[model samples]
Target: MKQGVLLIAVLTLNGCSSISPQECEVGDWFAIGKTDGQQGIASSKFRSYQKECAEHGLGSDFKAYEQGHAEGVLLYCTYDAGRELGQSGGAYNKVCTGALEPTFRLGYDRGRKWYQAESALLNLQKTLEQNAGTIEKLEQRIDDNTRELSVLKDKQQKQNLLDENRNLLQDLRQLNQMQGQLQRDLKQAELQFSLIQQGG
Candidate 1:
């Protein structure tokens, strides 16, 4: 059992390791760094690579890696890249510097705002759907209980069903009012999302 647990742990660690044994042997530190930078991965990730490579008795070239990363960062820090990342709800690593940072941030913020507006509209729509479904269920239950009440011969059972139906009707009325309000809110959210889409 202990051996099995140890084997599983080793397999899990190997699966999660970013660098493979073959990659460590090839020692393409520059390309690895460039890829990380292009993906907006943090500089600290190099330490993780170092640790993993060390396990394979390999050492990384920091100078070559840094040079490659700087070049790759230039490609990653564009306004369009930032906008696309923000739109996809991706986090910024604050990698862009000097002149590049401002434009990237501007695009990211605008895209992020649009994303938030769209998310809000979707949430409201989902709530409206749930409210309508609940109202329908309550109405159906009230109808079923009313029919059962009419056919029930026992006095106490009939009275209990009547009470249950009365509560259900009250709940249905409240839900109807909520549904109306949700419809209004949805319309407003839709208008807001439209405005955002139009860059208003």
Candidate 2:
């Protein structure tokens, strides 16, 4: 029977230790590198493995790791991948170089613009709903006050209530106007979003 060695080192980087002892013992450097590359991690990530492996008196296969990483990054440097990253608001790791960077950046920009348009549309809708609630509350108040005014026999009190109701009406009109403008804005955002989707 073969015995497994415990290779864990309680070494910390930025307040956390990333690799377990079993990872060091298995020494699957190619797979590790491929994963990091696909995830768009920077080359400097290898230092973390180097530091951990050194603690266990082992060394990494740098040539094999780099070879696998180079292959894996090819998939990460695609248009759809870039767009997905942008839509998720994830940062680019700046791993793609030379021939790939320009195309990926273009896709990222398009996706980010789409996300912004969607966000703007939602905000406009929320504002419109809030305005509607405010208008409802104001209308309810006006109705209550008008009912009270109708039964009042005192001339001065009835006149005051009438003036208050008039003010409420004016406020309701302004809110309606603002709501109209927000609706227009929402339409424009939706149109822009649709255009983006069509273009993509």
Tell me the tens digit of each residue's lDDT in model 2 across 29-73.
666666667767766677887888788787777776687678768
Candidate 1 per-residue C-alpha lDDT over 1-200 given as tens digits, one digit per residue, 9 for 90 to 100:
34333433443466524766666666656666666678676667778878988998888777877886787788888788888778788887678888889988987887787788889899998998898889888888888888888788999998898888888888888888888988898898889888877972
Give the C-alpha lDDT of model 2. Answer: 0.77
- Give candidate 1 misplaced runs (Cα > 4 Å): 1-17
Give the winner by TM-score.
Answer: 1
The 10 consecutive residues of candidate 2 with the worst lDDT sum are 1-10
Show model 2 residue runs off by greater than 4 Å: 1-17, 51-63, 152-164
lDDT of 2 at 45: 77
Instruction: Return the TM-score for each candidate structure.
Output: 0.85, 0.78
Q: How high is the CA lDDT of each candidate model?
A: 0.77, 0.77
